[model samples]
Target: MRLVIARCSVDYAGRLSAHLPLATRLLMVKGDGSLLIHSDGGSYKPLNWMSPPCTLEVGVPDDDAREAGVDAVWTVTHKKTADRLTVSIHEVLHDSEHELGVDPGLQKDGVESHLQKLLAEQIERLGDGYRLVRREYMTAIGPVDILATDADGASVAVELKRRGDIDGVEQLTRYLELMNRDPLLAPVQGVFAAQEIKPQARTLAEDRGIRCVVLDYDDMRGVDSGVPTLF
Candidate 1:
């Protein structure tokens, strides 16, 4: 009834003997608190590979399984202490809760960094122009989350939000206008990358050729596109 990870046997045709994805791999924890070693193929050897089949208790028994006038039984049991396997996945990136630190302002900075990391992962996979500009870009408006570019190599100023809000559209619009009209900055598209996207803001973005992306944390694990869109 307990779990452990060790060299176990399995029938060649058993379900667990099939190949599995590497991402699904996790450290196997055992009942005795020891870890199991993974095979060269990145799989655990099957429980019945080299061991005898699991014994079963059936309705009738043969002479070898009987005693006196009563029918004998054969029940499955582990041959050794290290036969169970349990897996646990480790997070590759820090969670938001880990952002708090000794310095209050640094805590805010940490939160931003975590959010940026999530966004960066998405941008990398979706393709280019996502750069983490400093908070120094914040004017009377708000902090700029990114300066993203679109497929056409057009720059796009971005504003990031931990969660979607009404102000994101307005803030991004102001930045977009500034960046598009000002000669100092490129005439770019606009986008707001956040955990969620408001319907109204999405409509507005489409109307202005601004790209608003709802960057779910689950989708940000890879690289990006080269275009930077402005929001």
Candidate 2:
């Protein structure tokens, strides 16, 4: 990871064009050759970025840019798309790089898979007559956390998340889009199931016609143990 704090401006041109005025910001050049610009706010999201499968070229500023107080120019070009980003740096406040070892992927808390298993076994918690078709239902994009049938025998694509977010809804949307193309699974419905769902995520799910269901972990465990549901 290469981290740089500098007074810079950014402009992107290609599929779309965007501009960021000069300001002190963090510039992240990742090991994969992607780049991200972040302001102090916006949670973990970056203000601008170029995803990997891209290249970055650095050059000295031209006379016009130099006259504008720009010292360096970084141009990033995407490999699979006609996207380009240019960053102009006036001053480098800080710069450093670190070698982060190869990632083995994320370390789960085990809470997610556990929730999925309990939900699959207690499929009826979704509604009366709902039955599990399969866990990790396979599709071209990826697995749908759970594939099940509603009382009417309609296909239900359930995405299990520890905390449901808009991205999760978007993921299930893609799965449903692809699954519905199949003659066998056409017209699949989506259920955004999670232990807790943010209000914005819930709104987006509903707006997208996906049902949202909040699960009770303790209650589910009790049900799995042969204890009755508290209701």
Best by TM-score: 2
User: Could you estimate the TM-score for every candidate?
Assistant: 0.41, 0.56
Q: Clashing residue pairs in candidate 2, if any?
A: none
Every candidate's lDDT: 0.48, 0.94
lDDT of 1 by residue, 81-177 (tens): 3232222222222112122335445345324466676665456533554444433265455556666555666666767776656667777888777
Candidate with best lDDT:
2
Give candidate 2's error at residue 229 in angstroms. Answer: 13
* Regions of candidate 2 where Cα sits further than 4 Å from its true position: 107-112, 116-215, 220-231
Error of 2 at 222 (Å): 6.5
Candidate 2 residue 189 C-alpha distance from true site, Å: 18
How high a TM-score does candidate 2 get?
A: 0.56
| Total backbone collisions, model 2 | 0
